[model samples]
Target: MATVNLDLTPIHQCSADGCTFNASASCHAPAITVGDHGANHCATFLGIPTKHSPTNDGHVGACQLSDCSHNADLTCTASTIEVGTSAGGGTECLTYSAA
Candidate 1:
């Protein structure tokens, strides 16, 4: 049988601070998106205080911040997902799975 490895580090240490979805080291958003090195910000990011074009899927994916323990296999057991801001004002999903 093929084995899958999952990394739950990135999700545990989200890099977004200005996002309203972030709280006490946990994300509370529904979803998030990412952009290129110089793309616009996500519309769902609460309290962003800015508007820009949507980013491409290539640079977008589920946020892994907060209590998220998603593995490298891209498997998430979180009942809900949170959206946060990236380093370059991009969007990211902060998914978490139950321990």
Candidate 2:
């Protein structure tokens, strides 16, 4: 397997305890995707047991919300973002804003 490095926006906080990449309220995934299925939700969120490597820092690698102000060419340009449980029973990016 090959790893691709990118200058991505960091995930400042994540309150989704059910997520595998959440560690102590912080995201530990190497990268996360937002706006999956054409919705402003965290597509990378997995409600599975067991956690990933804590040493891995989480970043917003991609975003599908083209209307979001923080989205630039399908990539998140926010300085930082927060992930949390949404009202519809899905994880979402709380930092999402209209352009």
Candidate 3:
């Protein structure tokens, strides 16, 4: 039996079609990092053409959005985060909000 530890994992929903970690519109990386890489994006993003897919769910590992309320010491404090390109392009944390 597998014990679910909520504290050890962070729910991260990604909707980047070209991302290698994106599987069925969800991120399959074990962990993801959000930062200002050409505008707050999923630093873990890898184009599908550049690699294969993952077999696991993604969790928010770190966040560099200092203006966001979920950012605590460069880490994401949110229990869950959404990643999308609608926020002015690129893979950005849709859940990012003003502090």
Candidate of highest TM-score: 2
TM-score, every prediction:
0.31, 0.90, 0.78
TM-score ranking, high to low: 2, 3, 1
CA lDDT scores, all candidates in order: 0.40, 0.88, 0.73
Tell me the tens digit of each residue's lDDT in model 3 across 1-99.
Answer: 223334533655677888887877777777777886425777888875754555656787777778888888877777788888874667788888888
- How well is each residue in 36-78 modelled by candidate 1, as lDDT tens digits? 2323334445666442332211122333333335433333444
Q: Backbone clashes in each candidate structure, one number apiece?
A: 10, 0, 0
> Which should have the higher TM-score, number 2 or number 3?
2
Least accurate stretch of 10 residues (summed lDDT) in model 2? 1-10
Ranking, lDDT, top scorer first: 2, 3, 1
| TM-score of model 3 vs. true structure | 0.78
What would the per-residue lDDT of candidate 2 be over residues 1-99, giving only the tens digit for each residue?
335365789899999999998999999888889997779899899888988768756899889999899999998888899999988878999999999
Candidate 2 vs candidate 3: the lDDT winner is 2
Candidate 2 colliding pairs = none
Could you tell me the TM-score of candidate 2?
0.90
Report the Cα lDDT for residue 42, model 3.
Answer: 78
Q: Name the runs in model 2 displaced over 4 angstroms.
A: 1-6
